[model samples]
Target: MSITLFRTLEMLRHVPREPRKITTSELRDRLAAANFDVTLRTIQRDLQKLSTVFPLISDERDHVFGWSWSRDAQVETLPGMDAATAITFAMAEEYLRDMLPSGVLELLAPHFDQARRVLDATDNGLNTWKRKVRVLPRSQPLIAPDVDPEIAQSVYDALLNDRRLKAVYRPRGREPREYDLSPQGLAFRDAVTYLVASHRDYDNVLMFALHRFLHADVTDEPARHLPGFDFDEWVQRGGFDADRHGEAIQLVAQFDMAVGDHLHETPIADDQHLARTDDDRLELIANVKDTHQLRWWLRGFGPDVEVIEPAEIRDWLIEGARQQISRYADASSGR
Candidate 1:
């Protein structure tokens, strides 16, 4: 394919599926707007080539055109692998990055290779492209830094198979303990990942952070799904307010106006609502799961922020500040 043809198809990728119809003149207008400088004839030839190789459906009489994908069409269309599968894997890689386990990537590597080969056969620049399209910085990972890959794989496999697991866990500041658990769900919270399960020892639902486990062993014991323990309800009750369960609580914090712009641009919450107070303070509302998590987040702002609501939360912040002040004074006194 010519560079012009490749560029045109790439542009079409951005167009929505429902509004798949585009007239020749509309296509030309779009190309011209994009500074492509291509003629109508070139666009027609490009569309024809795309239709033959891919799934570009058109109604000539109605002057309407759109793109759709079929399972068989996807399998047969790729110069080697279909566009859909290739795009899916590429997009997944872009989003998941280090969040995915190495074992999962190994399983996906072959499929990704097939897609790359197909793109290479097209002789498009995609084959030789080494552009840095996306960049994700290395920060402290959400999960524990030293979680054993083998143990992670075992838990993941158990989750996939709906199997029960027996494990020895050593909670922070606690002794090692063993339990037989029915794994109900898994979640990543406050930079930690946890397995929510029904514990035989407690006879209640409990969350065990994956990183805290000393050992995780899958058992042939029959999996038991808990009754009246709706995952969604349990999550919400735990103050997570998440869609399925453990819903996060919405928290609002007011900050001194000096750093309002900085806070607005670099939000501390995944979802934040910002407002300017009459007293020149910036109020930010965000969803958080636990008071401890919120306190830690607020501590990052030092004196610039103040907890605005949830009286208990505000008190906790005050107490944390007092503790820090005491520690500073004691350190100064060399005690």
Candidate 2:
């Protein structure tokens, strides 16, 4: 595609449908991010010229008005989506829609619609693929918390452009506080999304839950990065692990035959050993991380699994069982 056409197509994508709008300056900045490097006057002219051919409108009610696509515009994406691409987009739209930030999801709405159209037009077996697929949650489903779309948009923009972000964050069980964040990466864990970032000039990083952000805006200042920092390595090192103890531990446990049957095929760790015991139980030995998730998983197999080694874990389980029994007893006695 020609440079003008490419820039125009990208600009159109950035211009949200009414009643959402984008100012000329904002469009210029976004275009610059995509390496368009056009002047504000040039952006205004391009929008005015493109408006004649496309369903685009400029809101001139105010001194500094913005542009938007007409509410009913059926804009098709360039280099049309193929059947395979359509199916992939369809799957993502169905399965991962709720997990994405609202702002990001909104940006994908056009592609999702295009995917639906492409799939609908197809008369082949691929059209039925979406129906055949299934994604099941392992645990009981929890409703995803609401995240402010504007805040999410700002964070995304900042991260994409490697710019600093300013956000008003509300910590759990605490008052809201504003902070300057240098975003490193984003983590989508289960239902919640977290922004891994550093505060001000700090070298150490922290996680800010997207739902907990009251407000956010990106700044022009460049984001600071820790020297030789690797996001993947950080994840492997248990940066996001809750209630984490130092390193890996030798986990020795016993499980009832019925409960531990699946472990024979799907071991907990690479070095896991599972064998049938003389008493018809299953013995499990593995080296695993000591994390809150580990504890939760172990506790979930109540009465079906026993921690044979790791004195602290064993004692913790015993105390938890005792408390649970005591609570039931108290309830029975109307305490």
Candidate 3:
């Protein structure tokens, strides 16, 4: 290859090697940050053409299409990155990228470059171990929602520096209003990002969507804090899944053989018990915290599980089914 073509290939190789799933916009921005000066159009074209030769694949799974490599293609390539640090960043970026500080990707450009080299190494080591790993949510994968970058950046900046933000928050189905909020943290749940913040005068916390901010301005004053702010504690007790824990309830259900077998492999709770029924179905009884997640879990096994006790939960499910039936009552049936 010509010297310039060789350089192009060398740079492009790092993308699949770091094993990042990045959009064309992200790739172009990263290339620009690294001084490549490649245009977005050219980069898109290059990815398209290179896919025919390399293991590269374009994933349109979410709203933002990302270009990544086919992990199963075991082509021996060079690894130019450290095995440990690269894996940490790779996992973080993949799982929590939506919730990270807005300028993180830009700041992490150089590290990603080095990581790509290490991950691409042919040596059978931890650097290449990501190829054998996969992390997926139990819920059916939904397309990712969009967040405005500028709004997210200002929020991150204020939080990182302990400053406050003057933001316009438009809660769902409500009028847009402005408020001075002290940024606390960010939460990612079911593919959406929630900005955890508190008003200047009170210690009570409120959540605002990153995309809901029509306007944001970083203020000069330092943020005031409550006595103790533990992100995990706040999340577990009071954040997004608002009713994460409450009155514990006894849950008993009968499951079909398939759902029952899967539950045996991964019990929902430690105290769960499985007893054989006369009809060959699996009967399960467990004490679980009343939470939205539990309901969602049971819904996934629709037609395979039935609530056997706790008339309240049974009534809840029946009412839900009736509501759904009412919704479809006016609609025609599928052939």
Candidate 4:
């Protein structure tokens, strides 16, 4: 292709769908970055000419003129949206809409729209795959807490650009405080979104609930990385666990045979061994991290499971049961 064709095509790609737009200056800079090195006046002239043939519009209402593809434009690419790519984008829209940053999702709006159109138009059996499959959460779903859109965008930008954040954070049951945070990563657990970050000059990292930020602003200061911090490794070691004890423990528990049957297919740990005892009870032995999650899982089994080896865990369960019994006894007396 000629230089003109390439520049025009690159410029078109930078033009966002209506409501989101690119100024002539922004287009010129983007083109320069892409090695097109075009002038702002040239971009303006090209846009004016292209508007006659393509569904392009200029927003003259703004002080700085902005250009965009019309909201209902039917512009097609050289390589059209195929069935496979269409379905992948469709699935991303369905599953990842909540997890992705709002700004990123907005940028993908056009592709998502085209994906839906392609899937709806296809007569092949492949389009039916979306209807046949479903992803169910392992735990009961709760409504996600609402994070302020602008704050979320700021947090995302800081993390993406390796910059610091000035934030007013309110911890549960505590007064709101201001902090300069170095955002390391974002974690989405169940319905909550957390920003894994370190407070100014603090070596230790903490997870801040995104919804608890009263205010947030990205700063120009460069974010400092902890000497040996790896977000993935920290998460794997149960960093998010409320009662992490820093070491793995040998978990030995006994369960009623019928209730523990699922362990045969879905063991808690790779080293987990489940066997039937003479009394027809299920005995399980495994090496696993002793985290609050483990305790919660065991407690969820109630009378069906018993912690055998770890005296501390066994005592914990017994104390919990005793407290429950006492509470029930008092309630019965009142009745």
TM-score of each: 0.55, 0.89, 0.65, 0.79
Is candidate 2 or 3 superior in TM-score? 2
Poorly placed runs, candidate 4 (over 4 Å): 2-80, 92-112, 242-246
Question: Which regions of candidate 2 deviate over 4 angstroms?
Answer: 1-3, 10-39, 59-64, 68-75, 101-104
Q: Locate the minimum summed-lDDT window of 10 residues in model 1.
A: 69-78
Which residue pairs collide in model 4, if any?
none
lDDT of 1 by residue, 1-335 (tens): 78766676655653322222456666676667667787777777777777786666665455344433321233233354665556556656655545654434443455666666565565555544434355554335453245655466567756767778888888789899987888888876545567888877444677777767777777667667787767766765663433323335677788888865786678867788899988889898877665444455677678898887766668877998899999999999995
Measured with C-alpha atoms, the lDDT of residue 298 in candidate 1 is 70
lDDT of 3: 0.72
The best-first sequence of candidates by TM-score reads 2, 4, 3, 1
lDDT of 1 at 147: 63
lDDT of 1: 0.64
lDDT of 2 by residue, 1-335 (tens): 69998998888889977656889899998899899989989889988998999999988888869999886676475677899999999999888766776666766777788888899999998999999998877676565687876777788879998999998999999999999999999999877889999999999889999999998988889999988888888887788884473368999999999989999888899999998999999999999987777888999999999999899899999999999999999999995
Instruction: Supply candidate 3's per-residue lDDT for 74.
Output: 39
Model 1 ranges with Cα > 4 A deviation: 1-131, 135-143, 173-175, 201-203, 212-217, 239-252, 258-275, 284-290, 332-335
Q: Write the per-residue lDDT of candidate 4 for residues 172-279, one digit (tens) a residue.
A: 999999999999999987667899999999999988998899999888799989989998898888889845644689989999999899999999999899889888
Write down the TM-score for model 4.
0.79
lDDT score, candidate 1, position 82: 60
Report the number of the highest-lDDT candidate.
2
